[model samples]
Target chain A: MIVKSDEKYSTLGSLESELAISGLKSGSNLEKLLKAGYFVVTAELGPPRGADRTVIEKKATLLKGYADAFNITDCQTAVVRLSSITGGAILVGLGLEPIIQMTCRDRNRIAIQSDLLGAAALGIKNLLCLTGDHQKFGDHPGAKGVFDIDSLQLLQIVKGMRDEKKFQSGEEIEVEPRFFIGAAENPFADPFTYRAFRLAKKIRAGADFIQTQIIFNVDKFSAWMERVRALGLHKKVFILAGVAPIKSLLMAKYMKTHVPGMDIPDEIIKRMEKAKKGSAKTEGLNICLDVIEKVRKIEGVSGVHIMAIEWEEAIPEIAKRAGLLPRPSP
Target chain B: MIVADIKPFKEIMRLVKNYRKICVIGCGTCVTVCHAGGQKQVSEVAAQLRLAAKLEKKHLEVGEETILRQCEHEFIDSLEGLVQKYDAIVSLGCGIGVQMLAERFPHTRILPGLNTKFMGAPTEPGIFWERCVGCGNCILAETGGFCPVTRCAKGLLNGPCGGSQNGLCEVSPDTPCVWQLIYEQLEAQGMLDTMEAITPPKDWSVGQGGCGPRRLVLEHLVEEEKDKHKIAEKVLTRNDCKK
Candidate 1:
C-alpha cells in the first residue's frame, strides 16, 4: 500500500461516533467466531504477481488447517490478481470460509459497493478493507490508480449498507450484504500512545475488528495496547495482532527496507541470522510463535492473524507449540 | 492525459435505451488518467448494462473494448473490428472524443456516458480545475499566464467584473473572481498597468462560438476548420422502428 500520509496520532475516543455497528453487535460472524472460543486464526493469501496458480494452490492447501478462515487478497500490494472473486469462490468450494480482502484502489464507490453484494451472493462472510498500495509499486506500473474511497470510508460504506440499508447511490439497498468488517493497524509502526487512538478511529468508522500489521516486539505491542484499554477501546473493539513468520534472513531485511512503517528489531534480525544453517528459518518462525503466545495473554488483543506466506504448513506446528490449539473460543 | 469522473449507472442505462447490442468504448487517453473512462470503467459499464438488461428480463448483448485515444483518427482506426460488431457504441470520453467516435462509426449510433464538464487542468493529484476555455485568443504575454476568459465568470477582458466584491465572485462566494486573481498576479509582477490598458473589443467570429472552442497558445498547435460540422452524424435507425 502507498505509505499512507503521516498518521496523525490521537487518543482512541469514546464510542460517540455513530458508526451503527448493530448488525455485528450480537449475532455477527465475528461475534459467533469469538463466542465459539476458537483461536480464530485468519491468514492472507496474496495472489502471486504472475499468472501462475500453481504456487497459490500449494499455499492454499498448506494454510487450510491452521486458519479458521483463509483470506484471498484482492489486488494486494496494488498488484493485479487472477480475479479475487473467482479465487474466493474457489476457496469456498474447497470447504473453507474465505475472507475476501477488498481495497478502494481499483474500484469506484459503486464498483466496490456492488462487488460486496456480488461476494454476498456467492456467500463470503468475512470482509477486510484496505487503502491499497499505489499502482507504481505493483507489476503493472502503468495502470491507472482508482482510489475512489479509502479504507475508513469503505468500512463506513459496508456499515451503511448493512446497518443503515442504504447504498452510495442513495437508493434503498435491495440486497444488502452481511460482512464481518476488519480494518488494519500497526502498533509497532505507530508510536505507543497514538496507536490505540488510530485504531479507535477505525472502530468508530464501523470496523468490527482490526488485524494489525505483523508484531515483532510483544512488549511494545502490549504497552501500546495498555493505552488501548486506558482509552476504553477494550469495550468497543476487537484487535488482532498480525503475525507473519520470517522464513529467511532476506525476508527480515526486506521487511526492514521495503515494507514502510514496519520495524524488525536488530535483535530479531541477529537472532534469525545467527541460527545454524537449517534451523535459522525455524528459529525465526519460533519467535513469531512466542510473540503470539505472549500477545494472546495481553488483555486487549482479541485474536491473531497468522500469515505464514509460502511456509504455510509450519503455521499449525507453530500454533500447536504456542498452545493456541483449537483457537481461543469466546 | 485522460480526464474522468464517475456518473450514475441509471443515467448511462437510459442513454443506450433502444440498442440491442451495446458496445462500451473506453478512451485510453484523458478519461483513463482521470480514473473514469478506461478499461475498468468500460468493464463496469458493460457489467452494469448487463445487470440492467438482466433485470429487465432482456438478454441484450453488451460488449466492452477500449482504444488509445478516441479524439484522434489513428486511434479510431484501432476499433474497426469491434465497432462494426455492435448495434450502438456508448463512448466514455469527453465531448470532443465522443463526437470523433460518431464520425468514425458513421453507420452506428454513438452514445455518451460522461457529460463533459470543462477545459480543466489537474489542479492537484486526483483533482482537476477548469483553467482554460480555448477562446480562440491568448493575451498571456500581457496578462501573465492566467487566462481571463475561462476563469472570469463574466469573461471580462479589460478589468475585474463590477459584480466582484472583496475578491470573490458575486455569483458564488466560493469562487474567486479571475480578474481579481489576475490583478494580484500582475501587481506581484509590477505589471498592474496591463488592466488599465484598454484592449480592443473581441471578434466573435474568431472562436468556435456556440458549444466547443479551440485555440492555440504560442507554443502549441491549432487547427481552424471552416466546416467543423462536415462530419455530422446521420441516424442509422428509422423513426418507425424506434420512437
Candidate 2:
C-alpha cells in the first residue's frame, strides 16, 4: 500500500515475490525499493547555479529524512548551472542519498562514460537519465548542444556499468556502482497511450522506479496505471505518482494549460473559483486531499511527493488529510 | 547589477496581493544557472505562489513561460502572443533578464525575484567569483593569469605590496594574492625575472574612464578576415541546431 515516507516506510508486499522475480534476495536493501510489484519512491533536486553550499545543504538536510532518495539535475536546460556530479558528491558528504541526474545534451559518449564511472567512484547508487532540454531553452542559446546519446541509450550505459561490469570498450573500472534506474513520465502530455508502452520499455531496459509529472487528476492517473498493469509488467517495478497541491486558482490554470499531462477538470477549477473570496487556496488543498484519498484506494500507487515548494511546511497538513500521517519508527 | 534576492514567498505574495492574472516569466540563462530562474524553479515557484494565494483567499492565474533567454530581443519577443493577457509578470531571471522583460512589456508591470550579485565568472563547478570589474581594459598579458585590476585590494598593477605574505592577499583570508599568482606563473614560464625588470605604474584612466568597460583591440588583422566576416554577417542559419 502507499505508505508515507516522512520517517521509515514499509510497503505491503510479499518480499519473495519481488526478489524471486528480480533474483535479488529478500531482506535485501531493495525490499524497501520494490513493493507489491511496482517500485515508486522518487524525489526531485536541481543543481544550484552559483557556488554556495548553503542551499544544497539546507535542502538535503530537510529532505533526507523524508524522501527515499533525491535527484540532483545536470545543467538542466543547459543554462550553465552547477554540475550534478559536484552536487551529488556534496549530498554524499551530507549523508543524504542522492540520484545523479545525467543529461546527454552537454556530453559526448566518451564524457558520458567517464562521468558515469566517476559517479560510481563517489558511491552514488541511483541514476535518472534524460535527453536534456534543448539549448534554445537555456541561457546559452548560442551554445552548441551535444546529444551524442538519449535517455534510453544512457540506460544501456548504466546497465553496462553493472551487467558488463565495464565501460563501453570492455575496460573494467576498479569499482562499479549498482544503479537503481528511473525515468520520468507525463501522463497528461504523453501521446495518451505511449506512457505504458514507454514505461514497459524502460522496465525492460532497467528502470526500477517510475516518477510521473505533477498529477492534477488522481483518477486519470489510476486509469493510466491500470493499463501498465495489464501489460503484465505489474511484477517488474515501482511507480511513484506525483501530486502537486494547487496554491492558487491561477496556478491551477497554468499547470492545466502549460504543463504537459497535468489535467485539472473544470469541476475542480469551478470548486476553487466558486469558493469563498480568500478560501480558494484552502479549497484547492482540499481538492488535492480528495485526489490523494481516492488514489490511496487505487491498487498500485506506491507513494506521493507533495511539491509544496515554498509551502513545504504545509506538507504535514496535506499528508494528514491524504491519510499519509507520518508513520513513526517501524 | 541590482543586488536582489528572491524575497521570501510571503513577501512576494504580499506585494502582488491585488493582481489576479500573474504571469511568471522564467529565464533560461544565468538565473537558471543560479537556480533562481529555470523551468523547475518556475514550476516550483508557480506551485508555491499558488499555495500562498490559496491561504490569502485569492486566485491568481499564473502562466509559466521559459523562453530561450531574456537577454536576446528575439527571445524576449518570443513572449508576444501571451503578453497581452497577464496583469503583472514576476520575473525569475536575474536583473538583466527582468529589465529585458520590462523593456519588452512596458505596459505590463514587471517584478524581480532574485538578487543579482556581481560580474563574476564560475570559480569552479557552480561557484562564481567576481573577476572582471568591467573596468574598460584588460592587461592579463603582464600579470601572469591573474588580473590585479580586479583581484588587487588597491587595484595595484606594479609589484607585490608589503601586505602580500606567503602568497595570500592581505585584505581577506578567502582572497588569493594575485601578485603571488603572477610570481608562480611567471616563474613556471621562466619569465619571472623579465617581468620584474620593468615594474612601471599602470595608466588606470582608460579603465576608470567614463565608459567603465573593457575593450580588447590588440590584434585584429587576420588572413581569414573575409571568411570570418562572411560567417558572422550571413543571415542566421538553423543548420547547426541539429544533433
lDDT of every model, 2 decimals: 0.70, 0.66
In terms of lDDT, the poorest run of 10 residues in model 2 chain A is A4-13
- Output the number of the lDDT-best candidate: 1
Model 1 Cα lDDT, one tens digit per residue, B100-211? 9998889999988887776677877977878776656677777778876667544545454323445665445677767667777887898865654544334434654534
Q: A1-330, model 1: which lDDT tens digit per residue?
A: 111101121111222422223334424444566433333567777666677767667766766656667778787766677767767767776766677888766887779888889987887778888766656667787786665456666777787887888885567987688788877776764233335655766677778777887889777777888888887775566677788889888889888766655667888888888988988778888889878877777765656788776676777787677655654323
Error of 2 at A145 (Å): 2.6
Docking class of 2: incorrect
**Native contacts recovered by candidate 2, as a share?**
0.00
TM-score of each: 0.54, 0.51
lDDT of 2 by residue, A263-327 (tens): 77888778878889888778878887777666555555566655664455455566566554343
